[model samples]
Target: MQTRTYNHVDYLWDDTKAASLENDEVALFLYRSNILGSDLRITNYGGGNTSCKTIEKDPLSNKEVEVMWVKGSGGDIGTLTRQGIAGLYTERLRNLKNVYRGLEHEDEMVGLFNHCLFDLDSKAPSIDTPLHGLLPFKHIDHLHPDALIAIAATKNSKKITREIWGDTMGWVPWQRPGFDLGLQLEKCLKENPGIRGIVLESHGLFTWGDSSYECYLNSLEVIEIASEYIEGHVKKNGKVFGGQKLESLPSGKRIEQAAKLAPILRGLCSSENNMIGHFTDEERVLEFINSNDLEKLAPLGTSCPDHFLRTKIKPLVLSLDKEESLDNFNATVQILQPQFEDYRNDYKEYYEGCKHSNSPAVRDPNPVVIIYPGVGMFTFAKNKQTARVASEFYINAINVMRGAEAISTYVALPRQEAFDIEYWLLEEAKLQRMPKEKPLSRKIAIITGAAGGIGKAIAEKLVAEGANVVMTDVNQEALKETTKSMGKDEAIQTICDVTNTTSIEKMFDLSCLNFGGVDVVIHSAGLAISKPLEETTMTDWQLLQDVLVKGQFLLAQFGSDIMKKQGLGGNMVNIASKNGLVAGPNNVGYGTAKAAQLHMTRLLAAELGADKIRVNTVNPDGVIVGSKIWEGEWAEGRAKAYGVSVDELPSHYAKRNLLNEIILPEDVANAVFSLVAILDKSTGNTINVDGGMANAFVR
Candidate 1:
């Protein structure tokens, strides 16, 4: 079991460079903490904490004082800066051990921790600061690593730890993290002076050392030993797969049942005010879900107490037969909704069992993770960031469970302990103190022709405003590049041939699976034909109609269906053209098609208003500023029709407008978003971005 063979890399210390003279302890502490937090296997977004105790000169009295700087509340160690770690007077914090009334509630510990900050410039320290402060060492590292959680969550974890490492590590059974827990840790350390660290049963790992390197190595070495033990156990016992045999497709891919079931799962987690982000599609995740014992194995509890804050104690399990899901959401809701309600009711009863009359009121009873047979596992949360975090921890929890179960059985903390962590004030602060969401935050949007120009511009604006945008275009290569530029976390890309029903349906399905549902649609996809009516071929006219006219019809109808089904009522803005109101010479096809779309906007508004859905049009003129539409032959034809050089055409159009402004695609994009974001009660109306095209004005 003592397999400390993995080489631990010290990424922060540079041999060639001179170390900074100021505050070396705090500097080196952040350096090593960042290295530890950088690896997801060691820690995730906000799952771990690190601390360093040193003597610093107090700015007020200019006197030397013992100080402890730990990762602050809500700070991610991976990106920790000097400001991210709070500097607390170590002696002052320890003094609270006597004055503090063994553990009462109401976020008072958080307040007291805030009061102990050595400097006003420091942020609030973590709740576990007490535990870190009580340890007698220069550096202390606490990591909820997967390997550590694997061994610690086992039934005989304490006995196992004793057998493998002797007294180098002490074991503390589940004690809810607080002042009392800190006192318990102190007592354990005193009783076992030879221990290098302590593994909190059903919790996480703790290690300390006189130097930063010693602490880092101590943690890595001990964790590897535990990892080897589990690895050895797993190699002998083999692995456990869901006992159930999953159906496979002809192509050998597991039957993907997520698209059909996602909407119902999402609706089950929905509330009048919640916008749930749905997550799925990882290979390991899918395989785990396909396992036969999934229903039995998954509900045990969180692998670590900290994980309970996000995933809750257990998830809502959904089972399905192929027949029930064949009809998708329309049929699936009838089966899944009642089960979701039961899950919520059970959670309420579970919370009531621990209701101290002082616990934080129960949050929306919806489970964050929903596990299904064919669909695997999906995470639900109010925003993309939080949902992804939950999914990250949930995936790690599964690995921990598998590792533990491979050795013995995955035993979790008691229900009351799990409830304590879930309701702990520090964790509750994360939920209560969340920053105000953006106007379009948690909303999902779709943009057609999003590869470039106005469609792309609109997508960027909506994404900037906090909507998770799905960008679709006929150009697959361009769509990939577009997705990369927008940051993959919030952008989903797919090819959409708007005129084709199959392609359009696939685009909406992708949106539904990725973000749970769609709340806004901007129909900016279109094509144009510059030839005069006499010069236009029948095929030329038809191709323009297919992309411009038929595309809008499909988008409006399809987008409306999703919104109506969601019953949340959303916004749709059709990017009609100024040519629709005032036809331009040699632009017959483009203008006629755009005109039809403008009319369709009114029709959708009239029809969808009963559901509170709003539909409108943004009529943009001279929005050809940065478009590729002015390239090659298309550019030549447009300039020829205007009797101007290709380079001068934009200037010519600008002069023709009353404001003499060259309208960029972004200008039109702004106009389009204005309709969806600001025009809450106003629809069936057209806002023009034509820079005052007098003749283009509608009566």
Candidate 2:
């Protein structure tokens, strides 16, 4: 059960600015819509619609005419701008009651909406234009609030709605939305002149008033009544629903489980060209998954119809136990591997059942939301942001089902109706308008030693190119600040000690959870230890081997596993040293470890070629220009070995190369991006970013 008092707070609204000699009607409309959109409790992402009727002068006609400005299709209400709402002549749209009384083609209805537009270049109006056009009030607000739908979808809910709002609220039975539904609302108002709002069974609530603010307030008040009724009547705590007590996971373990499960789920759903991330894990989510009735209720279709386009009618359910049992999760993963194929097959069957001869092309049959016991639940999409959007709507749907069970059974539009909306031409057009993805857009990249230098530059490059990135460093604070500057939306920062197997595996796991699967890995993590054989201590030799030799093995091993499971070729870029090829004086330990890395890269290339995974390395010489690696005593020591001042050491190295220009981190990043993102024909090669060190060049 849920209890929320609808407070009529005008958020982000500036009345002083609105009143200062401008179009107050449109201003007030946008202001109110933003306030509602800003609250996910009322509407989410692109769900819901708002409209206001005003008399404005038609420039060509030279006469003031009634206009209905409504939220256009495919734009979010939270960020609705002036260009987002479409303006149409109210009389022209309403007059369609005569011509379109029985007009059945929704495509034609959409065309008619554009035809009646007061401004031809204006954005397209919402499909619900007919409903708003026929309403008598000057302003109308229609929100798909969870609480409102919870009450509306319950048994005898219409009676309860009348008790709550008395004659001020009306009830409309479920009907396919078109001219007929719009006529329903018009008749409701005429029959009950004092009605403040109308609750549509199996749909949502619609409210209207003389002013935008009043209309907004009416919406809030109506939702408040529904929320109170749910709180008072529905069960809230302890052993009431779900049957068994939820087996809760500790916060730490929950993250670990999700990290492990993400790649498995994403791998099952992915392909050579497209990737979908398993990107959700929350405490409440785990509880819902653990419920006994979860499988029964979660897949019954969405209480809010708008969510069908994002979350689909239901989810793919996998069975297991609590999150703490990693062994059970792994075992379940093995079982679910073949089962996922069945889910996709069933999805195709569902599509085949409802699709007509002239219907839109059937989309990929993979379910966007996946539910499993040990893994909780996850939502997937082509990218992280889209996955997050689906996750939000899915969670809302979970709550709707929960509320429905608490009061009465949750009734939703039949599966056929849902398919119609999901495959709508206008809805499909919105997806078509989305910008084409960059080459690496759906790819996930993991960058080691990402706190600074070549690694940071490469991470930034991948992010700019639309690859979802997970950056790792031993320095937690530096990693936090570095990623913070990049923003949280596209990147994830982790503290990974490359020398530790547990740390390395955890880093890969986090990347999978963040971006579905790892498609590219850049291993630039290393320690530079230059010492003569006589002076090199066992500690120094061991440290270099630990960070470079062992680190490369673990990274390639873990990364290639994901790529193999996904059956998609991936890229691995290892950072090596020119010292590995042509040893300089007192560069024993460093050169030995780097030589091992080069050989390992070649070995990986041979072994993983069957899977189409490419392995390559960049051998750089003294290109520490943009990193802090050469800033302190290490710089002085290297300068002393070169018999030059610290300031002259860079030039000394640069002059020895075939090309005299000093190499920068950006230069290394460009070469790395070339091999990983641009090049597709070659692997097992070393591209030197050393400005052409003649002695170290490899054939």
Candidate 1: segments with Cα more than 4 A from true spot? 1-4, 7-24, 105-107, 241-255, 281-283, 322-325, 474-485, 610-612, 632-645, 658-660
Worst 10 residues of 2 by lDDT: 1-10
> What's the residue-level lDDT of 149 in candidate 2?
77
Deviation from native of the Cα of residue 345 in model 1, angstroms: 1.8
Per-residue lDDT of candidate 2, residues 108-148 (tens digit)? 67778887898666787767888899997899998888777
TM-scores of all models?
Answer: 0.91, 0.88
Instruction: Tell me how far the alpha carbon of residue 436 in candidate 1 is from the true structure, in angstroms, after superposition.
Output: 0.9
* RMSD in order of candidates: 3.3, 3.9
Per-residue lDDT tens digits for candidate 1, residues 196-300, read 999988788899888776777787877778777877877787666534457423222223356555655666677535565666656667667767767777778
Superposed by TM-score, candidate 2 places the C-alpha of residue 674 at a distance from the truth, in angstroms, of: 2.8
Error of 1 at 127 (Å): 0.5
- Please give the clash total of every predicted structure, in order: 4, 1
